[model samples]
Target: MIRSGNPALKESTFLDLGTGAVVSRNAGAMTLNGTVNRTGILLLLCVLTATYTWNTALTPTGELAPGALLYILGGAIGGFILAMVTIFKKTWAPVTAPLYALAEGLFLGAISAMYEVKFNGIVLQAVLLTFGTLFALLMAYRSGWIKATENFKLGVVAATGGIALIYLATIVLGFFNINIPYIHESGLIGIAFSLFVVVVAALNLVLDFDFIETGVEQNAPKYMEWYAAFGLMVTLVWLYIEFLRLLSKLQSRN
Candidate 1:
């Protein structure tokens, strides 16, 4: 049975489902960095889109310009397509990963620009802190400092689901005047929530690692590499946004 804590599965490392080939545990295991490298081409596209959207603005003169809605739409559509591709691993990841990245880039850039106008400099700080957190999480994972256990997985998964529900509810509440307190600018509550989210996001990396390791061990198809990258990108995007929102909330209070 394919279970999370299968010892036999853990004993052997790195099986290519494409070829039914198995390699030593320490020999061919796919590392997170390696999977990222495989998807670098797609990531570059995302970066370009972000840069282009970041600079495209209405300026103080107020000429015709793409509004925040455009960025938000592009990001949403891209993310939807990305999820589709990830779920249908055979045909989507290879084709849509790059496009998804591009869309996200444009969205993040535009969002960052808007925030910059409102909060000034918080964007840069958020970016730096996001990367810092990513680096820290990766290092800790690699060093075996934070072991991924069944309980850890359940906690993060539950927290993530709760957060998603809250976000969706908040969005729906926008039309009714019932705002989600402590989410946007409720001071300490917002900060506490953000911190909890950050912790959950960081813990997601552990799940990501487990998936990668499991895939490699199970001999999942080669195309899964792109799918795996897509998953990582999704988590990273989430982490970045939470970081940005938390920073914005904190800055707004100051």
Candidate 2:
């Protein structure tokens, strides 16, 4: 069973793909090159939309443009719905994958802009750190220096799940006027927690690489290139957000 730390790239995701299936030529087969190209396309789309929302947030008038918040909320809600749609209907990825990228770009842009406003240049730092981590892990994974063994996958999956649950609990508690600034504060403990989350989030990228490679080896359908690209985007978004949060906490200490 091919496993990944990314929920979107679960164990059974590619189970039914490429098994004794008649694959067409190179173009019809899911190759690493094709997936990389698709990933680049998705990233371009995301960056384009994200730039729009980023500029809208910091309009020339020196204040947030009207409806900035609406875009953010729309992106968040729309992205979630579209993600669900893509997951259940993998064949629809060629259509929904780009849409998901655009939607997430909107959400990421608005939130990142807000963070930038509060902490100058934080967005750049997060972006650089995100890509830096991505390349670093990709290299390590390619070199077999960081193998995603069963135990490794399990540990990362558990860590990711725990972090998700903590955030869920925090949100649930917020409704009762309760808060856990313990993890949001700039103190050592909060910073420590954020660091841990970032590490786990980064580790997910390794699993993503492993998952994509496995898909290729399994001869997954050509469209699965898009699906795999989408999964990588999901992990990248999560890692970028975690980096932003960690940087914000550190900045607050200044």
TM-score of 2: 0.94
Error (Å) of candidate 1 at residue 11 is 18
Question: Candidate 2 — which residues are off by over 4 angstroms?
Answer: 17-27
Each candidate structure's TM-score, on Cα atoms with residue i matched to residue i, is: 0.82, 0.94
Tell me the TM-score of model 1.
0.82
Best by TM-score: 2
Span of ten consecutive residues with least summed lDDT in model 2: 15-24
Candidate 1 per-residue C-alpha lDDT over 112-215 given as tens digits, one digit per residue, 9 for 90 to 100: 77777777788788888877877787788879997777777667777877888888998899989998876567489888899888778767867776767677
- Taking every candidate in turn, the Cα RMSD to the unseen true structure, in Å, is 5.1, 2.0
CA lDDT, candidate 2, residue 191:
96
lDDT of each: 0.68, 0.89
- State how far residue 188 of model 2 sits from its true place (Å): 1.1
